[model samples]
Target: MLVNRDNPARSNMLAHMGSLQQAAYTRPIEYQEGRSHGLRGIEVKNGPLRFMSMADRALDIAQIEYRGENLTFLSKPGLNGRNQFDTNGAEAQRSIMGGLFFTCGFENICAPYVTPEGSKYPAGSYPMHGRIRTTPAEHVGSDAYWNEDGQYVLEVSGEMREAELFGENMVLRRRISSVYGTSTITVEDEVTNESFREEPLMWMYHCNFGWPLLDEGAEVVIPSRKATPRDETTAADATPWNEIGAPVDNKPESVYLHDLAADANGRSFAAVVNRRLGLGVVIEFDAADFPYFMEWKSMGSGDYVVGLEPSNSSVHGRGWHERRGDLHTIAPQATERKVVTFAVIEGDAAIDALVARRDALLAA
Candidate 1:
């Protein structure tokens, strides 16, 4: 007769954990019930980056700040309320799965682009476009890895990336295996999948910041010569005009200006003021990577959080050069990379630095 250990419950729990590890790594695995919905496992290390895996579905990241400082997520499965809704309405609602970093305008940029009579844009708007879903599903694969170097990496290929929390650090690497080039993202420290058969087009990087980390007082500074008009037909004509474009420049953080009349060097800059939270956020982009900067202030009244999106193409699937004829194009086998960084700064440091940078760029 085998004797039971001093703590029978402890022994059983250990045995259960061992079994789970074995099953999880058994080459091919399937999760049932609750495990399928919540995070299957989490890897904690470094200062505060938490890596999460949901069954076999997708991957997400949580920052250790803001209570856990939940900052970022790469959601492909469209968790809870995080799925993209129809662009037909004003201020399209973001997926509730969490905070996402990238959104593609399959039909239109803000509102579904249509003829003055209300007809939708042609089908080519989302060429080869398919549904982006969580990992562990068919044809969808996700990987979140970290080494001793303290550098963490997360890749979301087949589909898309989302924001689960307000202020976190999440990094994403995009691969276009068929094209031979890949785009990688390195974000603030806390934050899924899809298919292929068609090449990708009309994708935008939506970076969201809110209260505390990105309060109402946030300011945006660009290094471009000017700002151009944003393509949302309805919102385009609003008082103070919230949208603008830019001409490409090679300098870092060069996409800080705004354009209203679609001029080649027309870019502008602005600051975000949140009266409720008494905070601010500063945004800067690379003109070469993103030729336009669209400024949006939801004023904390609507579901909208302030966003400084860097996009490859313009609304309605128009490339930058379409208007200026100088937009960039990426070949199937070519890869392009863009970087945007946000740090917590107090008082006038953020605004001061932004102003100096903009002035220097304009002078040069």
Candidate 2:
């Protein structure tokens, strides 16, 4: 059976099925207002896992909690309760940093970049991480129903467009889903260029971790042969790239570029584990679309968090991409799809299993 968020008959049918198959009704999704940080969002609960995606913001995953404990990091001050376009440039970017996850890039550029010599941007223009995060999602919708195996599933989907009068026209259609009885959330996104001209496309999934899960002794595990620091500052502490430090008063942030080892299916995984807490979070994604994995470590007091970012381009601006000849372009009317899955691994056994998977992928 299927249920459409706007269809009353389908909704009633879903309710009837829920009564008939109570065991399959473990997934519950709710449309909430003034949720985390006073922002509107959709809350989905599946077993011991729950997540909230902000509807008023960039549709970023605002919170992810397991067993009543938040697994994701939130900014200290919290959501600003404002629209993306309400502010301009850097101010807009800083305002949306409160969420656990936010997308970057589509046009203009991701990362801080100076206008290239032949670029359309004016001279001395510095755009920090594309405007996509600040662009609110449109056509938001949610639905829940039983799958063929009688297991319930919930999904929230939306579309966001980044366009200007004579600028790039790109549309992103995103869907986040979860199945009952599981601690996993899957995100599938399709970015399309709806304009007549080809456009540069740079995107990154900024997934941040914090608090109990990111405390002392926590570590990041990835199947990579080599790691490169973003600059000399990071290179100085390169040996501890996989380790988390105790929060300090004014510790500087470090960034690294990981060349992951993927399996035969082009799939790779990374995880942040805290053995003392007996909990961890794993991110599995396709290496074809996002070949670069970046680790952002910020252990300063009141701003302690680690970001596991996967992207197609470097965190350096578009100019760097152009210089490196790694800039990706999407043709007019063409669409590109990317999929990522986030799952929680609990207990020593689960953590070991994740480690084994990474090892196996490396061995292959």
Candidate 3:
């Protein structure tokens, strides 16, 4: 039976079946200590999805798998296991490239910027992405329970702070949850400024796709009125940005900025569909929180992956946003909240329904 978010009865029914399936297949949610490359972390599994977050590293989602199919790309020399705080700028950036999802930006930098507006530190001192991905999350906890509607919910929550003796004082509280019997994950983040002054807040969700799910013939669908290529390298490949190519050796990566069209609720959706495999993943986010959408297409043989990034700022560095007065800032003691949801759509009917939703939003 198909579960519809708008139909509570159907959803409950699906949840019931999911609970039964859980008894036969697995638990609703399982958390256990996991070690990768001698680094310790926590692995969480809900239904058919599994993800890992290292304690030694920042709060990045290191790996994700659905039904034994690896949905995330893991580059060579995977999971360095090095504590992010101990690593320098270059090392931090290199370690991030392998994870399934890594956050970027907070106060000092995002995308490697050298700017005077940055912390009093000199240019090129801030990391490529901000320290959030490397700044470990404390107060980590997990729970699973049956809701009033009889739906089982699995959740994990944690807090990560970025601060120094005389630097930006910001804290982020994050929670990731999934419902039993569903292939959906929701990530909610609340960032607060604890300092006495306003602070620049830049953030991007780097959701990467790879391997069989990102193989040849897969297409990225976004309902956008216009898209801007980041540079000539991207512009040259913009003609067919919706399509994916076979793994080719030495193919340059392409980046594009999309001006998305949203629904009445100010929410936008994007998806990567592999029709041949009858599988796809959909990302839904609030445009009010993430005003920009960026796509990263790396078709290189070993580095073949695509990123569906939603951000408050363009993929451009902090300096660029500051110059254009586009940087997001939170007043002292103020907080900002954002939410993003990921769901797996399988089979022709489900995929078609997703496409229909996209078309409807575009038509509106």
The candidate that achieves the highest TM-score relative to the unseen native structure: 2
Q: Report the C-alpha lDDT of model 2 over 275-355, residue by residue, as the tens digit.
A: 999999999998988877888888889888998888987876578777777678899999999999998989999988888
Point out the worst 10-residue segment of candidate 1 by lDDT: 176-185
Name the lDDT of candidate 2: 0.76
lDDT of 3 by residue, 90-110 (tens): 556456645566777786444
Clashing pairs in 2: none
Per-candidate count of clashing residue pairs (backbone under 3 Å): 65, 0, 0
Q: How far in Å is the alpha carbon of 207 misplaced in model 2?
A: 0.5
Question: lDDT (CA) for every model shown?
Answer: 0.34, 0.76, 0.75
- What's each prediction's TM-score? 0.48, 0.87, 0.86
lDDT of 1: 0.34
lDDT-superior candidate, 1 or 3: 3
TM-score (C-alpha) between model 2 and the true structure: 0.87
Global fold similarity of model 3 (TM-score): 0.86
What local lDDT does model 2 show for residue 193?
98
